[model samples]
Target: MKQHLFHGYMTKNVQKRISEATTAILPSEREMNSGINKARRAMTPTIPTTQLFDIAEPFTKTLHDDDFLIVDKMITRRQRILLFASREQLKMLLGVDTILMDGTFSTCPSVFDQVYTIHAVKYDQSFPCVFGLLPNRLKTTYHFMFQELKSVAMQMQ
Candidate 1:
């Protein structure tokens, strides 16, 4: 099978193309899906079962241009928080006086309880500056996030 077909297309699309290319009997959709899943698992790095998994190398930077993406990673007594922002984003955030902060719970990964975002208003437009994956909504969590962001921003100036 051509490897490129498996790279970005959906499973069903790959399966259909593969089936059409050959005359031999093909595996059922369920079996093909299971095999595809197994292949994906084998290629991916193993993640810690607990919440303490280290960010893998592939995820540490931006994919297209390879710019640094992680601003901070903090582990407290109750939770682990990962803050993601580019240096330019941080500078924009620090430049503005009126910033907006919002916390969302529904779209976060299972390992995190919330996704907190900081937005900077520039010329009446709000641009997201920082994305934080937090474990809980405690006051200390917010404090830690803000303190770390401030530290990063200070160092950049």
Candidate 2:
């Protein structure tokens, strides 16, 4: 597409050939994305902030009564609570020796930062045992999460 008075013009064929012959790859180069957007589009339309909290109300209701579920707002930003683990999920996590942790930002909505998952091997297979939405990737935030989970695990034993 570059044009100069002395060089004239570059045709479509020339551009195509140039792109095809190039071997240099950028650091951020990624494969063409296709199916990734479909699931996001299929989801229910984005809910309002109030509704988002309302959706989580039932889960928070258990925080006071349930000894297993750990929900703490001070651990993260913007009142975005750090949900450590549910009773059943904690039980599963306690039973597993090898644990895996991963963070996914692509599927996370604008309401939160990233979906942090803690997985464990059970019955010779890996399963996502607990999920949490972190507001920021701070060392303190992660420490709080692991510390809470460790305390809960100790209580279970």
Q: All models: lDDT?
A: 0.79, 0.65
Worst 10 residues of 1 by lDDT: 65-74
My TM-score estimates for the predictions, one after another, are: 0.66, 0.55
Candidate 2: where are CA atoms >4 Å away?
1-69, 76-79
Give me candidate 1's TM-score against the actual structure: 0.66
Give me the candidate number with maximum lDDT.
Answer: 1
* Backbone clashes, candidate 2: 0
- Deviation from native of the Cα of residue 55 in model 1, angstroms: 1.1
Instruction: Give the per-residue lDDT digits (tens) of candidate 1, residues 1-157.
Output: 5676765466656567675646257777679889999999998887555567767766667665454555546566546888888777888988898999999999988878899999999999999988888889998888888888778777876
For candidate 2, give the lDDT of residue 6: 30
